[model samples]
Target: MTKRTALVSGAGIAGVTLAYWLTRGGWQTTLVERAGDLRSSGNPVDVRGPALSVAERMGILPELRAVATHAKAIRVLDSTGRSVARIPMSSRNGDIEVLRGDLARVLWSAGRDDAELLLDDTITDLRQDPDGADVTFERAAPRRFDLVVGADGLHSTVRRIVFGPEREFSEYLGLYVATVQLGGAPAEPDEVVLLNVPGRLLALHPARGEAGAAFIFRHPEIPGLERGDAGRQKQVITASYQGIGWRVPELLDRLEAADDLYFDAVSRISLDSWSRGRVVLLGDAASCVSLLGDGSTLAMAGADRLAAALAETPADLGAALRRYESGHRRLTGPKHRHIHRAAGLLVPASRFGLAARNNIARYVLGR
Candidate 1:
C-alpha cells in the first residue's frame, strides 16, 4: 500500500513535531520553513503537561531539561528600581522552562532526519481538491499532498491564503510585546527582574548565560504598522515607553541599535473552524492565547494529537482532520476564554491595579 503524504508549513514547535510523528506513523512528510535555518531567537517558553510526555515519547525530553533556563525567582520592581516583591519559582510536576529557540532547535534536531525539510521556501498558494491539495511555493515547484497543515504562526501566510485575512480572525488584546537580546549578563543571573508601571512592563530574563529584555505595554492597535518595518515598530515602542523609568532609557537606546528584535501585538486568534478541505491549521495559526497561554505546550500536544488522528484514519482524511480539531479545541478553548484574566495579572491597566498586583505578589504569592 502506498503511504500517505503530508505537508506541514512552519518549522516551529508545532510544525516540526507534527512532521516527526507523521513520519513515524508511516506518512511521507515534507516540512517547509521560510527561514534559511531554524530560528534561534525567541522568548522563553514552557514545556510542561502533555507536552512533556510528547517530548519524552520523542526521546528529546532529556535534552530539553539540559537546556532549561531554571530561573529561580521573579523579582518585581517599582519605577524607582526598588524591589517590591520576590516570588520564588516552583516546578509543577517537573515542568521545564527553556528558551523558545533552544526548544525549537532540540525538537528540530530530533525530527530533522524523519522528514524532508524545505528551507528558505514558503507556500504562496494552496488549492485543495477532494483527493489532495496542490501547493505552490516561492522557490520550490508545485506539489500535491494528501494533507496540508498550517502551523505557521499568529500571522500565518497559510492561514491568510486558506482561511481569509488575518484581521478577521485576530483579536487585538490592547497590548504589544517586544523582546531583544541585551549586551551584558543580568545582574541577578538566576532571577527575572521586572519593572512595572501602570500600563507597561520591562523585564530582564536571564537565560543561557545571557539576558534578554522584554517590553510589554498596553496600546490601541497602531494603524499602518507592518511586520517588516522594524524602524516603525521601534518608533512606536519608543513613543509608548517615552519618559518611563528604571533602565528603560538605556534599553530603548539598545533597541535602536538591536537588529534581532522581535515585536508583535499580543493578540489571540479565534477561528470558527481549523480545517478547510484538505488544508488544516495547527498551533497559533488556529487558536493563539498569546503570552499567558501555554502556547508552546499546547502546540506540541496539539501536533501529537493531530498526527495520531491522521494515523488512526489515513484513508479518511476528513474524519482525521475533524477529530484533530475537536480534540485539540478541548486543550486550547479554556485558555482562550481566560486570557483576559492573565493579561490583567501580567500588565495592569491602572496604577491602582498595578499596586494591587504588587501587593498580591508580595503577600499572597511571595509567601
Candidate 2:
C-alpha cells in the first residue's frame, strides 16, 4: 500500500503539531509556510490540559518548561501607573505559559526532520477531486496531495479558496489588538502589568530577557485597514490612544520605532463544517475563539485529534474528517460560546464594569 501524502499550510502551532503526528502515523507530510522561517515574535501562549499530553508525547515538554514565562502575577494598574490589584499566575493543573515564538520554535525543531518543509512559499490555487487535490504554489512546482489542511490561522488562504472569503465566516468582537516589543526591561519583570481605562488596555509582559507591550481597545472596524499596512495601523493606534495617561505615549513611541508589530482584530471564525471534500481546516481557521480564549491549547489538541482520526481511517477519508471535526468541536465549541465573557474580563466596555472587574480580581481572584 502506498503511503498517503498530506500538505499542511501554516507552520504555526497547529500545522507543526499536525505534521509531526501525521508523519509518526506513516503519512508523508509536507509543511508549507509563507514566511522564510518560523516566526520569532508573538504574544505568550499557554500549554495546558490535553496540549500538555501532546507536548509530553512529542518530548518537547522540557524545552517548553525551560522557556516558560514564569510570570508571578498580573498586576493591574490605575491610569497613573499605581497598582490597583494583582492576580497571581498560579495554575493548579500544571499549565505552562511560554512565549508564542518559543513554543513554535520548539515544535518546529521537533517536526522539521520528520516532514518536508516548503518555506517562503504558499498555495495559490487548489482543485480537489475524489482521490486527491491538485495544488499550485507561488514558487514551488505544482503537486497533488491526498489531503490538504489549512492551519493558516484567522486569515487562511486555504479556507478562503476552499470555503469562502474570510468576511463570510469571521465575527469581529468589536476590538483590535496589537503587540510590539519594548526596548528595555519591564519595571516589574516578574509580573504582567496591565493598565486599563474603560474599553482600552495596555499590558507589558516580560519574557526571556526583554518585554513586549500589548495594546487592546474596543473600536468599530476601521474602514480600509489593510493587513499589510503597518503605518496606517500605527496611526490608528496613535489616534485611539492619544492623550491617554500612563506609559502609553512611551509605548506608542516604541511602537513607531519597532520593526515587528503584530496587529489584528480580536475576531472569531464560525463554520458549519470543518472539512470539505479532501480539504480541511484546523486551529483558528476552523474555530477562532480570539486572543481571550486558550487558542494555542485548542490548536495543539485539535491537531493531535485530527492526525489520530486520519490514521484510524486512512481508507475512508470522509469518515476520518467527520471524526476529527466531531471530536475537536467538543473542545472548541465552548470556547467560541464563552469568548465574550473572557473579553469582558479582559477589556470591559464601561467604567462601572471595569471597576467591578478590578474588585473581583482583587477581592475574589487575588486571594
Candidate 3:
C-alpha cells in the first residue's frame, strides 16, 4: 500500500493534535503555521469532557494540571468598583483550566519531533481532485498531499480558499473583546477580578508569569478597526469602553504599551459541511463557538476524532472524511445551537439583563 501524506494547517491545539495522532497512526504529517512561532498569549481555556480524555490519552494531563491557572474565585464588581458578589470556582471540578499558551506548548512539544512544521507560511490556494489536493503556500513550494486539513481558526485561510467568503458562514454574537497582557498583576495570584457596566465586562486574571486583562462588550456590528493594526484596535477598545468605570481607565492606560493583544468579535462558524473532496476543516476552522464558549476543548477533541476517523479508512480517504464530518456534526451541532445563549450571559445586552444576571448569581451564591 502507498504511504498516506497529510498537510495540517495551523499549529494550534487542534492542528498539532491532529498531526500527532496522524503520525502515530503511521501517516506522514506536515504542519504549517502562519505565525512566525507558537503563540504564547491567550486566555486560560478549560479542558473538560472528551478533551480531558484526549489529553490523558496523550499523556499531557499531568503537565496541564501542574500549570493550571488556580483561579479559585471570580470577584464581580459593580460599575463603581463596589463588590457585588464573589462566585467561587470549583476546585475539585471534573475539568481543568490552563492557559492557552501552556496547553499549546505541551501539545507542540509532544508532536514537533514527529511531524514536519512549516512556520510563517500559509496556503494561498488548494486544488483538489479525486486523488489528492495540490496546495499552494504563500512562502513555500506547492505540494501534493493525500489530505489537507484546515485548523487555522475562525477566519481560516483554507476555508476562504476552498469554501466561499467568510461572511457567508460567520454568525456574530453582537459582542467584541480585547484581551491584552498586563505589565503587572491587578489582583491576587489565584483570583479573577471582574467588573461589569451594563454591556461591558473587564477582567484581569494571572497566567504565564504575568496578568491578562480582558474586555468584553456589546457591539452590534464589526468595528471600523483595520486588521493587523494594533493602534487602531486600541483606539476602538478605548472608545468602546470609555465610561465603564471601575479600574478600566487604568487597564486602558496599560493597554497602550501592551504588545500581545487579542481583539475580535464573538462569533460562531456554521458550515453545512466541514469538508470539500480531499480538503477538510478542523477545530475553529469548521465550527467555532468563539471567545465566550469552550472552543478550545472542542478543538482538541475534534482533532483527535478526525484523526481517528482517517486512521480507520486510510485507503478510502473520502469515506473517512465523510465519517468524520458525520460524527463531528453530531458532537458540535447542539453546542452551536445554544452557544449564543451562553454568550448572552457572558456579555449581557442591557442594564436589565446585567442586573438579572447578578441576581441569578446572588441567588446561586445564597444556595
lDDT on C-alpha atoms for all candidate structures? 0.90, 0.90, 0.83
TM-score of each: 0.97, 0.98, 0.95
- Winner of 1 and 3 under TM-score: 1
lDDT order, best first, reads 2, 1, 3
**Clash pairs (backbone) in predicted model 1:** none
lDDT of 3 at 23: 94
**In model 2, where is the ten-residue run with the lowest total lDDT?**
219-228
lDDT of 2 by residue, 1-367 (tens): 8889999999999999999999999999999999998885668888999999999999999999999995889999877888888889987588999889999999989878889999999999999999899999999999999999999998999999999999999988989998988867777889998998888999899876588889999999875463859998998889988888878887889899888898888888999999999999999999988575378999999999999999899789999999999999999888888889989989999999999998988899774
Quality of model 1 by C-alpha lDDT: 0.90
Q: How close is each model in CA RMSD to the real structure?
A: 1.2, 1.2, 1.7
Error of 1 at 360 (Å): 1.1
Off by over 4 Å in 3: 223-228, 365-367
